[model samples]
Target: MTGAASISRLVKKSFLGAYLEDALTLFEAGSFLAVIHQPDAYALAGTAGPAAHEDLLQRFADGVIPAPHTRELAVEGVVFGWLVLDTPSHAEASALDFVARSLREIISRELLRRGLGAETLEQYREVALLQRAVGKLNGSLDVYQVAHSLLDECMATSFPADHALVLFLDDASRTYRIVQSAGSRELPYAERIAQSRLFSEVLANACWDDADGEDTLASERMVKGEIVNDLTRDPRWDVDVPEVSRMLIVPLATSRIIHGALVMASGPSSRPFGSGHLKQTTTLATVTGIAMANAHHFHQVQRILMSLIQSIATAIDSRDTLTSGHSQRVARIAHSLARAVSQDRREFPDFAFTEMELQEIFYAGLLHDVGKIGVREEVLTKATRLHPRKLELIGMRLELWGAMHQREWTDLFERLQAINSAYDVSEEDEALLYRLANKSIAIGEATIEVLSADELSEFLTPRGNLNAEEWEEIKRHPAESHRILENIPFTSHFPRILQIIVQHHERLDGSGYPAGLEGDELLLQSRILAVADVYDSLRRDRHYKKALSQEMALAILEQEGRLNKLDARVVRVLTGALESVEHAEAPEPRAFGLGSPVDHP
Candidate 1:
């Protein structure tokens, strides 16, 4: 049979029954039939039964065809066995030859049918396994989880690897770094390679590089549908374990770039892998490359999102010079506090935060005052007694008033000249100006007094320079922030982010703005953000007041906790944590450390 003939499409089991029927017709009065071959071998088709089977088998046992009564079964001039006959008159010699030939066709057809069935079953099984592996790979977006899982599942497929290792490309270094390894527990050298920084060196020696010239066809040979069956006899191969007689190395790559390489090795006891193993492993390598690419892309997108969050925080803080780093400080403080709470697992047993949840808390703290963007710039940056422009206008008006009065009162003129030249005014001039400072000063003085009254009202108001109307405008920020974020697409990835952003200003007591969500109604993230915002604000210099000392800030936080405006346990934990950190040298702010491009195995 040709190679194509080995792949028979005849799967119907009825073919076996038809084959037996055709075989029976080849005999006239055959009493027995005997077919013998290698002992204990499994065959697809065989027959042994009845008087026909017994007497024909006895004739063959006598070591001859028994010419007139028996015929030999031969194919291509080689004896397969014999089909013996026992007839009243021996069948014609020509008829016996035809029978033997016909029986050969039937047996061949049966063998072909069985071979195809087994092949089809194996194909189905492999397909099922591949589907399961692909499903597991697609289930997670985490880089390391997907990498480890893919390596494990690929090992279980068609070829059982004795030892396997997956290397991911470190793009910056232009070298493969082992990211995952398996089945190397008993192999010291392999384990050492997996754990060492020079893992690439050991694996590179076993695998051929693509740079080998096409003239040698080395690349073609490596990619051929068969395992690279030869091993280079390097001194590094002196590992004293079972020798890896066969190895398979396939590139994990798409059309774009070579992402990494997959290396699988089998020891002496394993049957040598062939074309079939190489083909299956090549497919697995392709799937793994796609998965790694996707994971890398996912992490890249997360980094971009984190940068966007920080940028937004920086923008909000930039609106006021005094608050340049306010948002960042709050975010850092909130992150520290959350971590402290998480560490105290005994008191807060259910406390937990996935990376994403922690990110949300930090973002909420950074954006707590995002609504200030909507507040009037005047209100947002309002500082001392008067806006600088209003103060300057008042000063100009006072000078003009003094100049106009200088002409009418000679003594006042002399006083003004003395004030301008010698920085002194006569006693009479000072007394006269004091007596008339409020009632006697004319239009310019009256106008200045009116402006001054407003300034005094603002400066003496205790905290912040906002009037009732301006304070109301400032209060609208939280709601304005909610309105602004509502139109954003944050809900698509994290639906809870918007609610956390809106509730950052909320207090445990019913005193906080937007909505007076009190007590248990508040989310833990929101409470953490609120506490962080208050603490950072207290220790940060603002237009309204000087910055409080760390001790004073902690005291105020404690007082707020006692008043039920903040969680007391959180306050205590955060304060203690801050105290411990204050004495140590703090690191300067830098970009978030997502992770290194290449992880150690």
Candidate 2:
């Protein structure tokens, strides 16, 4: 077959046929087309003689392709091999040279497409990581928790470092203070590294400095909104470090305000951070700033809610004169006892009140007597057996009976005297006078008995003169309180607050109401409230009796504990707390937080 027609037919049968045909159209003497195997370079298929193909493959494998070589064939962005001319220097070779250049353009396009695909995938991965970090940052309401989580996320996302310092800018101090840190578990120096004066100075300088040209990228990121990856070269970082060490400083800031900065450092022999690390660190800082802002707002809302609750408690207390300031005193006592118990867990085993649980107890104490609002004013104010009005009615009935019998008693007295003879009388007359006098006395005594029945019954009663039915109504107040509280929605923060309140009056022996929950059934907080409530009640006068001295009240509490009417552990703790309160001066009321002393008033 002639060279052109033979080649055309061969191209039609092979996979390379289409490429070869189009390539040969530009030249009379057909050029060789083949695929190159990389690394161990060799031509898979070719139209040239074996000698020429071997020479081309050797040159490609040696990393040296001759000048004026045929076009490189690429598939899927990989250099496959060359499409070479069979007859070089011929007039057609010149035309075919252009063909090689066109093939090269096609390969270049494929390489560019592959590169773009890789970049797209990398971007997607970064976005996913960023979203995950942001989620972690916004998850907590506490400032320290947000800061710790921010540092954790940064380290998790490829910013490997042996040590890190998280500083928050105190607007009042106008300086950054280290709030949290992570890593460096083994070295004692590492533990104190973040607290070191040198470290503090560096961070402080970085935070306060403006974006002057002399400032290093580390400090300027705060002002210029950039990132610093190399602490070694940054003039802003004044610390002396080993040649192998590196650091990254990212500003914790948003568009509105700058919160702080995160300083991350890798020790000697550790890998240094690069541009990609700096980008992710910057993203983490941004997320952290948002989280901090959200946390601050969250705390503000919490403070407002606390104030609202306190107001409600105060309003509830104001409903009755007898219970004035009762709720506040009970809450303070409850808080103090709880703190005492927490400090000595060994003494009070199987009872550990977490921070949230303690808060629930405090709130429960403040609202424990809220149920009294449902009680009638007369019932609440009843200070004696038989209300005064009832006693007055009894007194009026007695006076009417006395007036009606007055004439009868006078006539009897006259008849008796007539029997005794108008003046000095005989023995019989005298005896008759004595008998009539005795009869009159008996009659008067009988009448008096009849009139005093209601008064005597009430006066003889030990507690308040509420009849059985009236007392039962008073007993239902706790349940009413529970019902009222149930209507108000509570969040997960106080899961068992209502339960504690409702069950506060329940005794260990099941003698107390409303549900009569006994030992082990009642919560620790319920027992605590019960003790605090009873202690305060005894310390203050009620409608039934005068207030008991603190020592007497404590003794009664101890008696109840012995009788199984109250929690013994709670009683003991509370007694100690009361003693402490009696001796110690009143302290300033402190906001609730760990390590703060309990408020006594």
Q: Tell me each candidate's RMSD, in Å, in order.
A: 41.2, 41.6
Off by over 4 Å in 2: 1-306, 345-347, 399-461, 581-601
* Best candidate (score: TM-score): 2
| Steric clash pairs (candidate 1) | 31-52, 32-52, 32-53, 32-56
- TM-score of every model versus the real structure: 0.38, 0.40
Best candidate (score: lDDT): 2
Off by over 4 Å in 1: 1-307, 345-350, 389-460, 491-493, 580-601
What shift in Å separates residue 174 of candidate 2 from its native position after superposition? 56
Alpha carbon lDDT of each predicted model? 0.58, 0.60
What clash pairs does model 2 have?
11-17, 36-80
Model 1 global lDDT (CA atoms, 0 to 1): 0.58
Question: 1-601, model 1: which lDDT tens digit per residue?
Answer: 0112211122222443354345556555443333333122312223423443444433445545556655544445544444444554556566556766776675566555445545543553344344344556656767567668867776666575677777777879765677777774444455333333223443333245456553232344332223545444543333333456566767665435556666777776676777777667765665565566675543443343334545566666765656877877777777667776787776577887765566666666666776786677677766643466655564455556657666344444334333322212356644544443452246644444423444434433434556666877877787877765553334333456667777877788878877888989888888888888888788887776778998999999899999998888788888778865333322222323235312111
lDDT of 2 at 201: 48
Error of 1 at 266 (Å): 76
Reference-based TM-score, model 2 = 0.40
